[model samples]
Structures are given as structure tokens and as C-alpha cells.
Target: MAGACVAALLASSACSSSQDASPMSDSSASNASQKLSGTVTVFAAASLKESFTTLGADFEKAHPGTKVTFSFGGSDSLAASITGGAPTDVFAAASPRTMAVVSDAGGVSGTPTTFVRNQLEIATRPGNPDAIGSLEDLTDPKLKVVLCDRTVPCGAAAQKALDGSKLKLTPVSYEQDVKGALTKVVLKEADAAVVYKTDVRAAGDKVGGVEFPESADAVNDYPIALLKDAPNAAAAKAFIDYVQSAAGQKVLTSAGFLKP
Candidate 1:
């Protein structure tokens, strides 16, 4: 009887020890699997805010130990950051021209792939009381118009479209970026502004967007690439891959962005 009791106690101890170690072992493995751990700072164009935020969340969930930090602004500004060594891991520009600036400066790791396409839209206050229908209407002296500065991608596209139609518009303000241009229209500060289709979609009820036929002449391609000196190269590559993936494309498309 004594021997049997001792044997039973030993068996119980061994089982408990094994069970306890199993969870710890599993935890160690889990930590090890998350080798790509760090904050990857991404500089993306303003129009990409909504879609990039969603994708960032998905990336964090997929890679347990990774954190993504994004700076959303004009493509020109983003290009300046990467060119000036702003400690950015990735860059997503609204135009290939902007991306080329970085690539020319040797700031990019590899070739950038075009992820999405965007075009200009006429954004006005909800209801569009002015009865503005076409690009030529923006030139009306009574109507207050706003446009992005020539440096920004949306502004460049807007310029191209306006030039194609031979419409001369003297906007009240030349905004620094697409969001800034849209804000003028949303706040009713201006009757209309040329902004990206994605910006119009993200603005919700703040403004109404009118698709102009001339927009086809000014479509801009969004390109993304990893930086050469990325602090977290693995995570940067992974995030870039995610943006080009089918799932990422779906997210952008849902946000009203055109696929590349």
C-alpha cells in the first residue's frame, strides 16, 4: 500500500511538471515566431489615410510584435522626408514622379510598384447650390475656388486637367495638400476645390463630389516602396507586400481608390 501511494504521488508530480512547462514552452515559441519586432514608420500620401490605417491595423494583428507608425501628408512632403533622412521605413507616394525623386536620391531599397490610381474630383458643399457642373464653371469670377499647390500630386493632376480643358481658374487659395484643398470646400469657405476621388469618399457628408470627364486626363498613380535605410527592413518589406497583396487592394478599392 505504501509503495503504491508513493508511485501515485510521483506520477502526479511528473504530470503537473510537464503540463506547466508546456505552456511556457509554447509562449517562448510564440515570442520567437514574432521575430520582426519594431516600429516601422511609414510616410504615405494624405489620400491614403483611411485605407492605410485599416491596413496598418491588419498588419499589427498579423504580426503580433510589430507596430506601424504612419505620417500622412502630401506626397511631395513625404518625398522630402525620405530624401532628407527622416528615419522613415517606407514611403507611399500619390505619383510616380514623387517616388522617382526618392529613387533618384538612392533612398529606396528596390523598385516601387504602383498600388492604386487616383483622379481629381470637384468637391463642393453638400447640395452644390452654385449649380456648378463642369470644370469651366470654376472659372466663374463669382465662385470661390480652391486648389492644391503645384508641388502636390493632386495639384499637379488638377493643373493637367485644367490645362487640357483650357480653363483658367484663379482659386482663392492654393492649399498645401489635397486635404487642405478639400477642407476649404467642406467648410464652405470656397465653392469648389479639385481633390482626389478617395478624399471625397473619406470626407463623408462634409462635402459632395462631382466626377468630371476631364478627370480622366489627370489620373495619378500611387506607388509604394521600402526605404534603403529602413530601421525594420523585414517589417517594412512585409508592410509593402501587404499593400500590394489582394487583401490590401480590396481595402483600397473599398475606400474608393482605383487599382493599379
Candidate 2:
């Protein structure tokens, strides 16, 4: 009777241990799945905000298990962040010059592709109160013109256009980014500003855009790339491929970007 009782106790203990081990195995599998389920962070240019946001949502819908997160700002600033280790999986810059900074820093995985192009436009207060119609008009002594600083892509393009046209503009303020320049015009701080065409469209009723012929001389190309040290390389590559697809091009084009 004693031996039988001891045998029963040992069997019970063994069964309990087996049941615990089974859940432990399941937990390990669950952890692995969780590891595969995470967000892919993207740093993109501010001009790309509208299009990229639309694409990000589409990407999430297509890839049910992955999340797409974005941080949009000036291209130069975005490149600086990637070089500084901001934990980004992908980067989309408004200029090749800015993308080169990341390439030089060994932050990008491969050659960045030109995904889209953008041109500068003169944004003014709605209703054309100043009757600003041309790039040469911005040089008017009475107009309070604003421009983006030379450090940003839009600023560089604006400079090229001005140089091409042999026109000099003395702006009331040199804003930090294209949007900032547009804001100056929107707030009536300046009578006009040279900002990206996309920005004017995005601003909707806040401002009006006037196209100039010299803009053709200074079209800026936007580039996109996956980072070399991306924590989620697979997802990053997928996102890149998606951006270069026809559907992605449609989204960008609809938002005023020129297909590359």
C-alpha cells in the first residue's frame, strides 16, 4: 500500500511538470511572434507628409502584422537624424544632396532611388491681394517676400531658380524650412514666398500658388532608401518597394509630386 501510494505521488508530480513545460513552449513561440510584430519607423521630408501618410495607411492595410510610423521634417534634418542613430528603418529625402549626407555617413543600405520631383512656387495670401504673378514680381521693393534658408532643399532650389533667372530677391525673412516660408505668407507676415508646389496645394484655402517659368530650371528630385542598420530590414525593403510601385506613384502624383 505504501509503495503504491508513493508511485501515485510521483506520477502526479511528473504530469504537473509536463503541463508547465507545454505552456513554456507555447510562451516561447508567442515571444517569437511578438518579436516579428513591430513598427517600422520612417523619416521623410515634410513635403512628403500628405502622400506618405496615405501610403503608410495603405501599407499597413496590405501588411496586417506590421505598423508604419513616420516623422516628417526638412530633408536635411531627417538625414541628420538618421546619421545620428534615430532608430529609423527608412528615409525619404527631398534632395539628392541631403540623401548624400546619409550615404556618406554609411546610413543607407543601397543607392537611393529618385522617387519623385517637386518645383518651387510663389505662395501668397488668398485672393491675390498683392497681384503677385511672376518670380520677377517677388523682387518688387514693396513686397515683403520670404524665402527658405539655404540649408534646406527648397531653399537651394529657390536659389538655383533665382540664379538661373538672374533675379535677386531680398526677403523679409529666411525661414528654416519650406513650410515655414509658406507660413510667413499665410500669416500675412510676408506678401509672398517661394515654396514647393505641393506645400501650396496642401495649404488649401490658406494660400494661393502662382507658377513661374524659371521653376523648370530648378526642379528638385526626392529620393527614398532603406537604412543599413534597420532593425526590420524585411519590412523596410517591402516599404521601399511599395513606394516605387505604380500605386505609390499615383499617391505621390496626386499630392503634386512629379514621378521620377
Candidate 3:
């Protein structure tokens, strides 16, 4: 009887040890990995609205306990904000030049990676009432053209394109961001606006997009970096990694943004 009891006890101990050694279920593992909670503030260029917003949602879904908040505006303005002490976790600029502003100030932690590229386009009211066809059309004195402020990436790119075409033109208004420039056209406040192609696409039928060859001269390369003082550094790095992933590439390309 004693021998039989000892053998049974050994078998029970083995079963307990096996149970302890078993791997956690996939759901439990996911829950454990998703313990990253709290808000991740992202400052991205205005042009990245669609794709970045989609990625933010995906990131949230991937990390159930975490939340992503965004501040989208002109890249230069956003970079300034970061440098000026506006609390931010990630900074995604439309131009490396603008990002250099933050990098120069040591506002970010690591090297910024170029994630996407964009080109300028003329955004006009539906039907292009200005009869705008090329970059020189913007030189028409009678046209009330709006452009992104020269400080903004879109505006800087527009200047490059204009310089490349050797066309001297001036805009009636220099808005803070591409969206502001597009809004002027959408609201008929201006005849046209020099904005990013993505902005024109986002505006849909509200505006007509005119692609000029000179835009190639000012194709902007977007770069993203994690802020040095990121409140959520771990989640910030994870978000940046996700943005460079294949899934994120699909979302960005679907929005007409070029792969990096």
C-alpha cells in the first residue's frame, strides 16, 4: 500500500510540474505585452493625417491599455512646438530640414528615419476656375493664390518648385499649413493654393489637384523621431517601429504617400 501511494504521489508531482512549465495562452501573453498604458502624444505634419490617424487607431488596438493623442500641423510649426517645450513623445516632420530644427535643439532622442515622401500640387476650387494648368499659371496677376507659409515644409517645397521653374510668383496669403491653404480654396477664399498632393487628395472633390513637373524638384522626405524627454518612451519607440512596419507601409501608400 505504501509503495503504491509513493508512486501515485510522484505522478501527481510530475503533473503539477508539467502544468507549471506550460506556456501561457496567446490571449494572456498578449495581455501581458500590452500592459503599456497612458497617453502617447504625437506631433505629425498636416499631410500625415489620414495614415497617421489610421496607425494611431491600429496602435491603440494593438495596445489595448494605451492611448495615442496627436497634434497635426505644419511640420515647421510642429517642430517649433517641440523645441519650445510643448510636451510631445514623437515628432514626424514633412521635411528633414524642419526636423533638423528639433535635432539641433536636442529635442529628440535618436536619429530620425525618413518614412515617406511627398510632392507639391496646386489645389484649386472644383473645375479649376482659375484655368490653372502649370506652375507658371500661378504667376497670373489676376489669380488670388494662397500658399503654405514659407516656414512650412509645403511652402518651402513650393518655393523650390517655383525656383526650379524660374517663375517669379507671389501668393495672396501664406497660411500656416497645407490644410489651411487648401481650406482657402475649399471655401473659395482664394483662387488656388500650393499644397501637398496628399492635401489635395484628402480634400477630395472640394478641390482639383494639378500636378506640375517642377514638383519633382521639391519632393519632401518625411522623417520621424522620438523626443528625448518622451513621457512614454517605451510606447513611443513601439509606435515608431510600427509605423515602419509593412502594415503601416500599406496604410501610408494607400493614402498616396510614397514609401521611404
> Per-candidate TM vs. native?
0.87, 0.85, 0.91
In the predicted model 3, the residue pairs found to clash are: none
Which 10 residues in a row give candidate 2 its minimum summed lDDT?
31-40
lDDT (tens digit, per residue) of candidate 2 on 1-260 = 99999999999999999999999999999866544346889999888888899999998888778899999888888888888888999999989999999999998888999999998899989988999889999999999999988899999999999999899989889887787898898888988899999999999999988999999989999988989999998888888998999999999898899978
Clashing pairs in 2: none
Residue-wise lDDT of candidate 3 within 1-260, one digit each (tens)? 99999999999999998787665566688767767888999999999988899999999999888899999998888887899999999999999999999999998898999999998889988998768999899899999999888898898899888888789887898999888899999999999999888888888999999999999889999999999999999899999999999998888888888888
Please list the residue runs of candidate 3 whose C-alpha ends up more than 4 Å from where it truly belongs after superposition.
1-16, 19-22, 25-34
The alpha-carbon deviation from the true structure for residue 145 of candidate 2, after best TM-score superposition, in angstroms, is 1.2
Question: If the candidates were sorted by their lDDT against the true structure, best first, what order would they fall in?
Answer: 1, 3, 2
Q: 73, model 2: CA deviation in Å?
A: 1.1
lDDT of 3: 0.90
Q: List the residue pairs that clash in candidate 1.
A: none
**Candidate 1 error regions (>4 Å):** 1-34
**What is model 3's C-alpha RMSD?**
2.5
